[model samples]
Target: MMTRRGVQWISSAADDPEECREHWALDPRSPHALPAGRYFDVVAVGQRVGLETFDQLQRHGMPLGPVMADRASEQVGFFLPTWAKSPFDRMVRQETADRAPEYRYLGENSVVVVPGPMPLAGDRYIWLRAPMRRPEASLPRIAALAAMFVAASSVVARADRYGREQSAASVDGGATHAH
Candidate 1:
């Protein structure tokens, strides 16, 4: 028999960039300032699993980038099936495997944590897997996550610098040729 699940209704402190930034900073694992620009910050699903994590998040659809964490820390990251073939996938899977068995079970301990500001109203119930306790595990997974984010940041930084340099060069070249 399928067990009935309850929604936890997870809510972000703020949906806007400024508010997100503030809240992100408060998280032990989030960056003080996320990359400046629009990104996929929300995922819509008709039904969600308990305390959505990376694996659960992936069940919905593709997000803009890798699922980092609720905060700046790498303690919580989700894995996408599309990424199943990558080394990162292995890392995520291992982490998921090592988590408490409760997370994988859809018994009683399941609840969905939705954003508080979401316009969702009325009582809607669904089945969800029980969430695993945030285990006190080794830092290796966190280290792996840090490496992934650092590499991503490096790529973005290099791209931004290159773009700026190209823009300046184009402007200078155009001015000289105009004379």
Candidate 2:
């Protein structure tokens, strides 16, 4: 569970905390834009890939910080420390250069819309993994996250290929030959 102080710290990532607060006050379910690469940088991945990576990380006992899921975009954002932007970007570029699992790194000159601390009805963005105590300390390092992503993407790709092959085989097998 996130404490009030944790929420305040997260909101402070915005350029204007007051503006963010005002927006949330007007519509609690509304998402507010916060500048990336300040308090943290966000690595956005497809929902499936992200979930797989997250599961792998958890299974490996790696610490996870705040993670948000955007249903409208079908993306999951993993928050990393501010200093991780450059390394994470490099890793993403290297890992995803001509790959199925695409990654979007929101660093400097980027904006990320995040939901309120507590999710509400009709919220398009919600926390899949909420910030825990000492959120910053709980963030995963670039190497750990990158490795997990690579492994997870491989698993997802293999599964997708297998599914496609099965469907194709079923379709072909259903056809009758003239003989």
For model 1, the stretches where C-alpha displacement exceeds 4 angstroms are 1-138, 174-179
lDDT (tens digit, per residue) of candidate 1 on 1-179: 11111011111212354565345235422222222112212221111121333343345442313222232111232222222224443444454524312212111222222221211223122112221222222344333442343333344456779888788879888443343
Per-model TM-score, in order, reads 0.28, 0.82
- RMSD values for the candidates in order, in angstroms, are 16.4, 3.9
Candidate 1 structure lDDT: 0.30
- Judged by TM-score, which candidate is best? 2
lDDT of 2 at 44: 94
Worst 10 residues of 2 by lDDT: 132-141
